[model samples]
Target: MDENSIAGAAREFGGKVQGAAGTVAGNDETRAEGKRDEVGGATETRVGQASDTVRDVAGEAGDLADRAIDTGRDVLPEAGAAPRRGGDTLTQYAKEFPLAFAAMAGALGYLLAVAIRRRR
Candidate 1:
């Protein structure tokens, strides 16, 4: 958001400069191109805002999933220590259900990425 707003402001400033200079120098093309750039920058700012929203939503969802996983991990261990002994059992289950685990992991990773991107 900050970046987009900064860029947009920069573009706006540049456009004002270009338009002034073009008028003084009598160059229609420079004026037109400057207008185009100003528009592009505005569009980029909007896009950046949209991206930030998506990233925020994704990060929130990921945080929720992480909490759920933490709960599950907590409950499962307390459920029964027999057969499912120690941390190895969970690891083994993950290995056995590779597809399922992979899917979950993928989701988790995606959320993490979104959160990280938003932070940046």
Candidate 2:
């Protein structure tokens, strides 16, 4: 446990002891003080737990990010090569069938325009 957690537990234990002593001695003020200490200790313990949880989550996020970066590095070259090959094939086809490609391109643009107009 962290310092805060340990301190909180100690405070809580002391409060309980004080409260019991006050009860035996018939001292209302000591009893109230003991109760207050118990609450403070509980708050401290919660704060410590929250801090530990945050640290754990942050470490996990960092690990996930590192893994993502490594995966992207490993896959990028092969993934990138496919797009270049596809572009080259399209270029060759366009060169061999210029008129047909132009017609198809114009039709595609017109269809896209119509689709956009309908959406609006």
Question: What are the lDDT scores of the predictions, listed in order?
Answer: 0.82, 0.88
Q: Superposing all C-alpha atoms, what RMSD in Å does each candidate have to the true structure?
A: 15.0, 5.3
Could you estimate the TM-score for every candidate? 0.48, 0.62
Among the numbered candidates, top lDDT falls to 2
Alpha carbon deviation, residue 21, candidate 2 (Å): 1.2
Per residue, candidate 2 scores C-alpha lDDT tens digits across 1-120 of: 567888997898888888888888999999888888988898888888888888899999999999998898797857767889999998999999999999999999999999999999
Worst 10-residue stretch by lDDT in candidate 1?
Answer: 77-86
List ranges where model 1 is wrong by over 4 Å: 2-5, 20-27, 73-120
lDDT of candidate 1 vs native? 0.82
User: Total clashing residue pairs per candidate?
Assistant: 0, 0
- Candidate 1 per-residue lDDT, tens place, 1-120, comes to 658867876887788788778878899998887777778777777777787888899999999999988898788866655655767876987989989988998999999999999998
